[model samples]
Target: MRFKLSTVVLPSVLLLGSACIVEAPGGTSPEQRRAATVTQIPPLSVRNGANLGRKVELVAATVQPGRLTPGERATVTVYFKVLEALEEDYLIFVHVEDVGGRMERMNVDHKPAGGLLPTSQWKPGETVKDEFSIYIPSNESPKALNIWLGLWDPRTDSRLALTNPDQVRNDGRNRILLAQVPVAQ
Candidate 1:
């Protein structure tokens, strides 16, 4: 039994190509994400809270180094409480924007807990603490920066509604205003 070169090589090539095409959630390749560490802790009082639809509440959001400067690193930690179980897994979009909120500098968009525990997996009454870091580019002007976050279904391109519109400030795109860090001039 002799195997033709075309048959052997074609199958091998096809397998190799397919293996390289794996897609992570939101159509991003795996190499695009930074490692994330998320922890679960007992429920606490919400220092700053906003309701995302009726299923989840953004309990609190805090930024370290309270201020920022060009080429500096800042860490953002957010807390959430599941108000109700969700059926669809949603991605969290964390946006760093200019002071005026007219332009976006960068976005740290990823699945909850780095995809280890998605929104669909969250249970009612559970408190989730997620932390991630971002670098302030040196090219940005010495102006305050705003950090915004929200949940969205990447497939449908729709964001979860921010129920407390009166209490929370949004970008008109449903993104909650998480924090504002003053940049050293």
Candidate 2:
């Protein structure tokens, strides 16, 4: 049976003290990114963590109606494109953590559209869109939650490579912290 989309509530955020991230002196140039190996990603199986996600880039990740209440549902939309052809299907991973680094969160792991659309169907250089609803747990009190997004292959339980290693958490799990979701009491 295929793995269903489910929320695994972990006790607390993994607080690895913030590390400084350095960007290009001026800005990202196509020539620079291509040189970094981000513009061309290889298949997941033969991939290396050091390569990061230079090939398939996550363009925009937004939480509609950004604020959430206990037990409420919110829509999350993501826009991304593959700079090169991808040969394997990948999963979307979402993790909601408190801004204070305290309290628990719901981490979601599943395929697109509840196991319908797979990343393998993505065409090179074509932008792909994905949307889904996330239900905030009623058990916890209201707080600001950071919504982190990333891609992983369920078959091997491995996270896709990322480009920036300093600004985000590089747990070797390939997660990218995308946005902040305010939980109102």
Q: Which sections of candidate 2 miss by over 4 Å?
A: 1-52, 113-116, 166-173
TM-score of each: 0.72, 0.63
Report the backbone clash tally of model 2. Answer: 6
106-163 per-residue lDDT for model 1 (tens digits):
7777667545466776778777666667666666654666667899899999899988
- Model 1, stretches more than 4 Å misplaced? 1-46, 100-104
Worst 10 residues of 2 by lDDT: 11-20
C-alpha local distance difference test of each model: 0.61, 0.53
TM-score of 1: 0.72
Give lDDT for model 1. Answer: 0.61
- In the order shown, the candidates' Cα RMSDs to the true structure are 18.1, 14.0
